[model samples]
Target: MSVNIDLEITVTGPLDAEQAERIADALNDVAQDEGIQHDISFVVDEWEGRIEVVGGTEYPLIITRFGQWQPTFESRVHGAVQAVALAAKADIKWGYPDDED
Candidate 1:
């Protein structure tokens, strides 16, 4: 049986092109280091010239799908995210997509 898992990481801030690229690179490195075969993508939302005040630190969202899931998958994912967050100086919110809906 093949186990597949989808992950979503939401970063709550404005992301520029460079920042997005950095995040993507970080995610790729994470996946590679963990021996996880994954397809990762990113989405950066535009606020439409409207400045909405967020009460806390903002981060970027990272979406990844794994070809196989293992028991320690979540921890591996978190570790990856943490490494990126620390390097980027950002906060992150993440979860499995299936758990959302």
Candidate 2:
């Protein structure tokens, strides 16, 4: 095949301050793993920080972000992934069809 494919990954969610920090770290790893050479794109967008309800019911710290990937190089990040130590396990969404649906 003379055509090339663009590999991309995006991350987004609502999480606490700590969780958001961890997620951000994880996203960096993901981006490094995918590699810019492979046209990989990564991004994190923070949406909700705090939500309030009636009776002064304030919600915890909430954050939402997104990561996109597209490798411009070859062979991924070549094992030189930028990972963080002692970080929470981030939930990865692979865009797989909902089997339960």
Candidate 3:
């Protein structure tokens, strides 16, 4: 049996190559610890932003912070999202079985 955790996390706003790599590293590190081999990817946009914490403190208004967990039809997706959500303190948005379209 293969265990893989696939979750969607958004890191928005203008990003340079370095910032993207760091984001990948952090997500990978978390996934590895949970026995999941997966990656975090983002599609950047002008207004989309993610809050960044450097040296563990001080956030730039330019950066935005977000955490979301959506339950899919797949069981594996559920596991991954749940695991990732548990690892963070920020509030997470969980998709509902009856989400308003």
Best by lDDT: 1
* lDDT of each residue in 1-101, candidate 3, tens digit only: 21222233443334454554454455445445534333332222233354421211121111112122222222333343344343322222223222233
- Candidates ranked, most accurate by TM-score first: 1, 3, 2
Candidate 1's displacement at residue 68, Å, is 16
The runs of at least 3 residues in candidate 1 whose Cα sits more than 4 Å from the true structure, single-residue gaps closed, are 1-4, 39-101
Which model scores highest in TM-score? 1
Candidate 2, residues 51-95, lDDT tens digits: the string is 111010022111122122212221232222223222223222222
Runs in model 2 deviating more than 4 A are 1-14, 37-45, 48-101
Model 1: per-residue Cα lDDT over 15-84, one tens digit each:
4555555555665555566544244444443366522111111322233343234435555544554554
How close is every model to the real structure, measured as TM-score? 0.38, 0.31, 0.33
Say which prediction, candidate 1 or candidate 2, comes out ahead on lDDT: 1
Superposed Cα deviation of residue 19, candidate 3 (Å): 1.1
